[model samples]
Target: MELNRFYCGDAIKIMQTFSDNAIHLICADPPYNLGKDYGNTIDRKEWSAYETFTRDWLTQAIRVLRNDGTLYVFMGVRFIARLYAILENDFGLLFNGWITWHYTQGMGRIKGYSPRHEDVLYFTKSKDFTFNLDDIRIPQKYYRERNNMDGANPGDVWQFSHVHYSSKEREEHPTQKPEAVLERMIRASSNPGDIVLDPFVGSGTTCKVARDLGRRWIGIDVNPDYIAMSERRMAQTATLFDSFDPRLKRTPLDLPR
Candidate 1:
């Protein structure tokens, strides 16, 4: 219920206390049901039980979201389609984009190809939503005379490196997201001083990025360790925030005209 702070509790229960249409943006990265250890909480759930959990939390998220608010949910391949159905068919939120987060390295497989991507479903509560395309634009591949000259629209498929265990930005959480990924979402969807909510704030990437960008944030996680982890990470980041998209280094090819 508090803004710009991390609350340790059940996401659904905590979210219920929020007033209606109070959130400008919601970035939810719930359990993928992969049986990963999350400290005091089990990631594994029965198929029906998982569906119920997903539906309930999503309902709360949608309730708190403003009419023009945007919601971006990170999901695994196992339940991506079902989640999409719940958002579009059941809830009727307008489908905005299906973003693919492509990483270079991941678990390799002998029987099949190694998985290198995760999907994020972007939806909006209504037709008109806040999307500052210029705010999120990445450097263009090549500069042209007729081009806007600002930057190019970062397409649906995004390339950001994983916060590797060796990296300093890596947190204790198993499925911690890259900070650059959340930064793009927050910058594009919400304005400065707007309230951004992360219901399942694992590792608190969303909240940290929101705060660094001058937006109000609320992050709730069931695990106390994660809350502490996020707090330490935020405290350490005063001037410079964590890592960024690797592609940001690419300078647009200059053309003589």
Candidate 2:
């Protein structure tokens, strides 16, 4: 079990090689079964086949997770409810939160309201899990003697713009996520030197952020091209994150003397 390495292979098979209770945190953004082109693979699968795939990978993911480990999975609306049930009822993972990632821009739909958000299901292997509130808190909205002043819990609804195609940090991957989103997860759920794993690494935002934050990481992706893309990004010098919570910049009103 090598740390800080990218394995270009099937996620389930790759995870099966890991020892049980080995991973401290996992941030996964698997395909949404929306028929997207992912170079060597297609995101489309029969409903039954997709469910089987989901269960298979999750079984391995849960096995590899430490007792105190946390998992955050990104999903589109179509299958989010099903995913939640599978995590809680079938796998017996403890539900921590249902996070809605609200983005300001997206493709328009004339037939219905445009989709503006994606869901991230947060779960833990057990009741006791790592969550560094101070590391992930947002600034207070108003000054008060009672306020913790350190910051406030970011809550379940997160606002981060998609990594725009024209941005220098953007990769060729179809669903590349903003670095700040992964940063928040890594910062909150795991401490420095803990092992972070991303089974469906995509463009590798999870691995990149984990490395930047001093954590050991493993990234698994089926596509060799994406492995190369991740490697390229990892080789670059670290910079300020591409996006962040707007609340981080807000000034508290009426400072107390």
Candidate 3:
């Protein structure tokens, strides 16, 4: 089936139509089971049903991925245990890293130092997968100190924080991830013109970043609002996606202030 640039529909059903080995990467930001209002949040699910849901998507995603393709799933820190069980029991050796995106926010009024980071679970279909570490390195705060080491390869503790509170990228959606974060993943994981799939494309941030970086992207969102927001964001981006370059001056994405 010839999928268009973006689709506004149920992600599971839409994913079923895609061909095997077609997509290079599946970067999913599915519901976190936080029991809150996502654009069109599913009525909260029971534990068994939640596992079933994960299994269903994993089955379909694995089928569509090439041997070299990778699946990167972002979830809350609290979800690690259950999700890890699901990955181990169901997917076996395919599990890769329990990469932590260490951000600098999320502390509540309670006891501990707040929960700011997230888990970006990496699962490759096979041993041979695309992972170019050199391309995604953040500039060393102390470039002079590190003489030979290839920039600060922070390994999973991604030190970059979420978009700042005064950041312009903040959207109405509570769960919107920053574009800088997506930029790192898209760059380090896939090459230019690679097929990047974002199944839960809230506010189309992933698609926008993909487009701005010259990747061929397919974004599916359950909400029309998100789809519209993504399209507007694309239009806001001046260059045609085909001509985009990573070296272009990063136009700070506008957001609610």
TM-score of each prediction: 0.95, 0.98, 0.83
Candidate ranking (TM-score, best to worst): 2, 1, 3
On residues 1-257, what C-alpha lDDT tens digit does candidate 1 reach at each position? 67889999999999999999999999999999989899898889997899999999998999999999999999999999999999999999999999999998899999998999999999999988999999988778788877776878888999888989998778888999988899999999999999999999989899889999999999999989899998887796544545666667789888776
Q: How many steric clashes does model 1 contain?
A: 0
Clashes of each: 0, 0, 0
- For residues 227-250, write the lDDT of model 2, one tens digit per residue: 999999899888999998999999
Give lDDT for model 1: 0.91
Whose lDDT is greatest here?
A: 2
lDDT of 3 by residue, 129-237 (tens): 8887887654343435334235444466665556555656566676777776677778877888888898889877788888788788899888888888777777774
What clash pairs does model 2 have?
none
Off by over 4 Å in 3: 1-4, 111-113, 139-150, 164-166, 238-257
Worst 10 residues of 3 by lDDT: 240-249
lDDT of each: 0.91, 0.95, 0.73
